[model samples]
Target: MEAAHGTSHFLRDGVVMLGFALGFVLLFRRLGLGATLGYLVAGVVIGPQVLGLIGDAESMIGFAELGIVLLLFIVGLELAPARLWAMKREILGLGLVQVALCGIALTAAIGLATNFSWAAAVALGMPLALSSTAQVLPMLQSAGRLKTPFGERAFSILLFQDLSIIAMITVVAALSRNPADAGGPPGWQLALMTLAAIAGLIIAGRFLVRPLFRLIGGLGEREMFIVAALFTIAACAGTMELLGLSTALGAFLAGVMLADTPYRHELETDVEPFRSILLGLFFLAVGMMLDLQAIADRPVFVAVAAIGLIAIKASVIGGIAMIIGMGWRNALALGLLLSQGGEFGFVMFAQAQAGLLISPEAASLFGAVVTLSMASTPFLMMLTAPLRRAAQSTEQREEPNNDGAGALVIGYGRFGQTVAQMLMLSDIRVTLIDIDTEMIDVAGTFGSKVYFGDGTRIDLLRQAGAADAEALLFCLDGAQLDAGVLGAVREAFPRPKIFVRAFDRRTLIDLRDAPHDFAVREVMESAVTMARAALEMLGENLQDIDAAEQEYRRNDDERLDAQRAAGDYGAAREMVISHQTELAARARLRIPGRPTNRTGAGR
Candidate 1:
């Protein structure tokens, strides 16, 4: 009877979580909001206080553990030595100063105002100094600000925070003051164990990980790769535990060592599902820890603490951003970006609890501060546009008038460069901008007028003769995004003819419906080429291929026109399903009896 009741409770918990996750994802999409925020909200809704779905969060902590491990590994993969070196000034210099300043200032203030001891205040401040990378990065990517200077600065600072968490772990472990316990391992023993463990991790990661990857690669099974990644994570985490250090520190070290691998990105991709699930679980577990009834009893205090934490963090970050020469608007944007107490805060606070570094009440206060501040970031980012526009209204702006009269090619890839080269051969000038610096350097040696930067940036577009250009060619890879770029072009240079390339059916639909003058797919060009070759082999005259090409162009244009009128690909795909037979019959009629190469007969 007891066993059956336990199983039933477990089943109910799983069902509730599943329902919450489904509804959460669906609502996020429906509302056009970030899924992270949606997940957080889902946790709140299904929390013990709200729905009493997840009655015991302790069972989910193991899953949360896996999430942090995978997340740190992925973070390490992104932080290759070269990239880390590139941002050293910001990460080590500005980042270090900011963390120290914020921690000291906030801790002192809390100690002075409240009856909290210095140790308790320091514990509170330590966690609050960190910022949420999971939240900020996704938000920046969605806003198309990830490649901006401010974004780069934010990323550097976040990386520093991640690295700094290891220090926090060591400090918390060392300073642990249990009332019942007299002492821990000797200081030298602790130091040696930490060093040896770190050394062991480096040796294993450097020697073991690559060969393991090679073996996994040889298996030619994706599941094997995932298994290997999990094994490595667990092994490292277990090793750290044996050495009396936090599993996070071990996982982070493992990641840092594997950062230089060619397979790092692939590893990241493989582990992404596990990372995402774990991260969601972590957030849910955090939500479950919220003492809602307690908060309800002390609503004013919790609310004040949440609000005060955000305000203090924002003010400090804003001050630093301004001192670093960011404009008021940019400072405000960055301030909000850095205002949150991150996932590490939860980890640190949990550690503090285990070590008896803080009382239960203090830990709860820390949790409230972290959750409320993190929850407010999306809303804060929403204010960026208005704040920026307001700043622009009062500032004098310099608009560039194009000095070079040319065709502006936004991407200098194979397709884009070919178009630019062809135009140049015919004495038409061309200017290009690409985000890859190496590509630009190589293109420059060939006398190509190439600039290195993201094409979506208005400033880069303007410098690339956007206004004075005769035509704009959007021949980049990932051309579905061209529709959005076209909108920007229309706003900047509405009169220019926009020539674009579509990769497939979906992109074709996107481009067809987009407000642009010319939209062509590589499929059309390849089809024309194949037709020309077939004509040569069949002893057909030049006029035949030309006529066939013209017919193909006409057919594609007509298809696009019809699809655009329908406003979505579903209707167009249905149109294809309904008319494929009729189109094939029309092609057979157009081809004189039987076509030699049926593949090239029509698009």
Candidate 2:
């Protein structure tokens, strides 16, 4: 009875936490404050300091730290080894310089600001040099700028910060005044262990993890992939824990090993939800653990420290970015975006407490500082919106040249090439536009001039002579077009005939409401040809194969028409599945002297 009662209590806590989180997140998000702050506020409200609804914020935090580890893993998956190497300059230059400068600068500031010695200040301050990865990354992703150069640079610095966590730990351990830390290995030993662990994890990833994923993939078990992805993170993180190293780094390394693998997208899809929930939980726990009494006692100190931290980091980072040749506006935006003290600050502060570098009260004070700094970011961004927009407008992207061309091909990939060549065969003047710079360079070498710019952008299309061109063929790969884009294009320049290359059947169905002269399924023709060849290889007559092909095409068209009008596949599913038997019956009826099975046919 007691065990059942405990389970109910546990369920109650879960319900309260999630419900409060949802409500607060919705409110904060509606207010344009972002969900991180909402989660933090909810945590505080539900915590012991307020309503006392939740239990053991510290233990909740320990479990929630997995969110950080998973987030690093996903970030690592975005950077393949080759890409990481390509970013060596920014990682080492901007990242390393920014971290070193901020650490030293903050250390001095903290040392002078409070009663702590130089060592304690260093321990507390180094963590503040790191910004909230959990906050910044989601913002970049939501803005669809994660693949942009600015985002890449921001991520490079964050990646380096994650890598530097071990070094920070070592610095803290080396400066320890506690008896417990006295028995730990020296900094040099820790460094060697980190190197060995990294090497082993990489080897295991190639030998063990990839093979494990391959086996699960061949079995076609998506559930197993989820299991495998989580297991990989746990295994790496657990290994790092055993070695007294950073588990987040371990998970990150695991992700990096599989970064270039075919399963990267699948792994990201599987692990992202867990990362999000845990990350939110992490922020909540951080909030819950924030000492309200401590903040109330010295609100001025907390406010000043938080503001100073933001100011110092932003100035230092912005200066470095400008020195590295970024425009002042972009530099300022980047700095403000990363000004908040990171989630890892809590971990470092805990380390400081364990090392006897700072008291729990001091740690809580700095934690509050970090939290306050974080809360200021959305406001900072909102204030800088105009500057960022102006900077983006002047960014150096190749513009399309106006040529009195009859046809403009948007993509220069395999699909676009065929379309362009076919059009040129008719002696029509074709203007080629492609977003891929490398492909354009290669095409130039082959004496083909393809302009570089986003073809989907309405302004770019207009500049590329979309109005004057006889045909505007969207041959870009994937489902880049939607009803919104198609509608805009149609409304903007209705004179040119529009053709779209759909990635699949779903793409075609999705844009059925949009106005377009024609939609070409990227693979439909080739697939039909392959099916015809297969039939021939199976000893089926060409005449019968043609009939079969014609029947399938007719049925497909009927299904598409039905699906388009109904806005669902339910009404069209039977048209596809039931067509086989009908086709066979029709074929038999066409045979000479075949018996008619249909009603009133034999008469």
Candidate 3:
């Protein structure tokens, strides 16, 4: 009876939490605030400090941290190996400088303003150098800028911040005031173990993980994909935890391993819901743990310190961005966008407390400071929209799927499959797109990579390489092609030779004056082949059959031309071959003709 009542309590709490999240998130977003803020605000309202409805936020944080881990994994999926390598300069140069300078400056501020020793300041300040990836990434994505160059720059900095966690932890551990932590691994030993673990994960991803996913893909079990994706994250995260490394880092590595493959979109789709819910829960837990009483006791100090941290980090980062040749506007926007304390700050503070460097109250106070700084970022960006807009004009737009392909075939059905394979046979690089997930799964079984999306969407096509492709093949099965879409595609991506599939003679006629370079009636060639075979079966001479076929094609072309001009399927009825003319043709070919009614129009 007790266990059942406990379950009922959990169920009730779940309802209340999610319901609050739904209401507040919608309201906050309506007020131009982001969902993270909404979730945080919602948690605060229901938390022990307020309504006292939800308790034990400290325990909730461990589970909610998976949201962060999954988020890193998703971010890693966006960074293919080549893309990561391409940002090496930004990651090492700009990112390193931002973290180092920000950490130092914040450390000094803490030391000067507080009673804490230099060791505690270093332990606390370095982690604050990182920004909230969970909050900022969604904002960038919602605004459709996550793939832009400015976004890339922001991402590079964040990646380095994530990479710096290990070093930060090492520093905190080495400065440990606790005798228990003193016997823990040294910095050098930890670094070596991190490297070894990373190598092992890479090797496993290549040899074991990828093959497992492939087997699952071959089986075409979508539910199993969700299962496999979750397992991958869990297994990798568990390994890192076992080795005293960041579980988020392990999930990130797993995502990177699979990023270059065709299954990324599928994995992303499957794992996204979990990431969203858990991440919201993470922010909610963060709010519940804000220690409002601690902040209320020293409100002015918390508020001032939070503002100072934002200013220092923004100035340092903006200055670095400018030094790296970003426009001043973009530089400033980038600075403000990343000018908040990160989720990792809480973890680092807890670590400091564990090392006996700071008290729980000190950690809670700093955590409140971080939260307030984070709360201010949305408003800052909203007020600074002009700078971002002006700067974005000078930057390159997103190229999400620029795979250096020469042809983009926009359907993977029978027709698109043949068209794509022929291009491949001639050694042309091609990117294939279709809206069918089942087909994509099956295609993976045969080593064919088909992206899932509506190819008719110009944005999707552009991402699939339409701009750079030498040819655009619209091989949709039905009369899905039209003049307006073709014309729009031609104007938007004039570099590609647009070829469309016409479902019938009528569809061909409808598109006769469209902007496409070519259109083939889906059944025209097969009909011609069938006519030739029937003539051969009748023992007609090859020479005469060829002449008859040419004559028939000439009439068909003339009638199709007339129909296109008139924009009517029934137009040019007089141009079709009559029974008398057919009889004359039979006489000329020396074949008997039986009197019969003429067939209707093939269309």
The TM-scores, one per candidate, come to 0.65, 0.70, 0.75
Better of 2 and 3 by TM-score: 3
How would you encode candidate 2's per-residue C-alpha lDDT over 1-603 as one tens digit per residue?
999998998899889999999999999988888899999999999999999999689989999999989988987787766567888998888899999999999999999878898999899889999998888987886765555667878989998898788689778766767776567887667778888999999999999987787666656566877898999999998999899777877888888888866566567766788999999999999989989999999999999999999999999999999998999998999999999999889889998898899999999999999999999999999999899889778765321222357888988999999999999999887878775546665777888867655678676676556776788999999888898998999898888889999998888889998999999899999999999998788666778778778877887888888888888756666666453566564666472232445434652
Which digits, one per residue and each the tens of the lDDT, describe model 1 over residues 1-603? 999998998888878876787788678747655566676677778877787777777668666867888888778777878677878898898788778887877888778878877777777787788888888887776765555567777888888888888777767766777754356675346667787888878987878886676555555565776788778878888889876687887777777776765455456656777888888778777777777766777888777877777788888888998898888887887877789888888778888887787877777777876887887776776667699556445544322222344687777888888888898898776767665445655776786645444566454565445766778887777643656766777888875687877777568776554678876776767777886897788776676567666665666566677777786666544334234644564475465443536658643
TM-score of 2: 0.70
Q: In candidate 3, what are the lDDT values of residues 1-603, reduced to their tens digit?
A: 999999998898889889998999999999988998999899899899999888878788888989988987887787776666888998888889999999999999899988999999999889989999887887887777776788878988998888787688667756777777467787567767777988999899989987787677667566787798899999998998898777877898889888877667667767788988998999999998888999889999899989998999999999999998888999899999999999888878888998789999999999998999999999999999887888877887744334368888988998899899999999888888776656777898998978755577676676556776789999998988888888889988998899988899888898887898888888888898999998788666787778888878887898899999899999998766787777666676665543243323331
Deviating ranges (above 4 Å) for candidate 2: 143-148, 397-603
Clashing pairs in 3: none
Which candidate number has the best TM-score? 3
- Candidate 1 wrongly placed segments (more than 4 Å): 1-8, 25-33, 179-183, 186-192, 389-603
Candidate 3 clashes: the total is: 0
